[model samples]
Target: MMEPETRESLIARLPDHADTTAWLEFVQLYEPLIYGIGRRHGLQPTDATDLVQEVLLAVAQSIERFKPDQQRGRFRSWLFGVARNHSLNKLRSLRGQPQPAGGSEAFKQLDQVAAPTSLEQEFTTAFRRRAFRWAARRVRQSVQPTTWEAFSRTAVDCQSAGDVAEDLGVEIGSVYLARSRVMSRLKRLVQEVSGDGFEAIEGELR
Candidate 1:
């Protein structure tokens, strides 16, 4: 889980330009996911990189006006909508240009792209995968080696709890305890990284 100061900073400072720390943290956490969303939408690597910049620029331009309305939706969902609009704009521009000599096939593939919802679904999946990985890394650093191993063996490697207990020379109950603690921390970390908007996106995906 994030330190209390860090979490508070993110929550309080992310919307306006007042918090450089929070803005940097926000960019570090979401930029890769935004880039991945662009690639999944059939953008070339350079174009995807450009898309990340464009989305972040848009966020910077409009974040002050972004209120967290639980009745309406989540911040991440709003961010996703911005990304989708920018991506489609890029696609339309690309479609209007003459195909490059060697990139016609890529353009053809782009031409066959599915609807915006498909891109949104891919973005959510990618976001979840990145969030879990980031949370697991943070938890691993703070946990005891034995505790982390036990949790990984049982929850990730799919070993039986009994088997993990024996391998670690601990009681089965200890193994269960370790897994539970690690999982709880992981969930908290994911929530911290995703902020207040995660649940709304999760509900839509479900």
Candidate 2:
């Protein structure tokens, strides 16, 4: 029962500087996913770190302007736009001819105009992994050590079930059983975080 606030409510509260709870939620949900996207797109570690800060700043400035469209995604689109914009600037800057864009207008324009293309896949992948990590962290602490290791070694580390069983001093059947149990719980947590499209994400979490 490690339920967290939904991203929509998290976004709703992000604008209030006084809401430390909301900001904490934002950091927990976003910082890693945004930073991971930056790295996967070929940014250096330092650049990825800067991308997180830059994206946050951009969001803080533009949060009020966000309008959720029934035909569109809310934060996913805005975040993808903001992250893409900053990431491109960093990449171009590395090449010595960066295009300058700033303020809420830059973000607003991108959010309004950018269709789910190019960076959209990156956004989705990073999002699932974020959900995975977020759920796994919570699940890990709540589960028994052997059970966690069974799931970790098999599902995460990709070790063979027999090997994991031997390493953990359990039967091979127990290994698969542990994995299934952990996976079931993990899926529930991920579904809560993702809110929809769990079918698409189900296979990827493994």
Expressed as tens digits, the lDDT of each residue in 117-204 for candidate 1 is 7876677677766666766888999999999999999977889999989988999999999999998887677667765344443444
Residues 6-118 of candidate 2 have per-residue lDDT tens digits of: 55544677678788876776788888878876665566677789999999888888777777653256567668877877876776566543424433233233235435485
In candidate 2, stretches whose alpha carbon ends up further than 4 angstroms from where it belongs are 1-16, 19-22, 36-47, 90-116, 146-185
Per-candidate TM-score against the hidden true structure: 0.76, 0.58
Q: Residue 113 in candidate 1 has what lDDT?
A: 66
The total of clashing pairs for model 1 equals 0
C-alpha local distance difference test of each model: 0.75, 0.72
Best by TM-score: 1
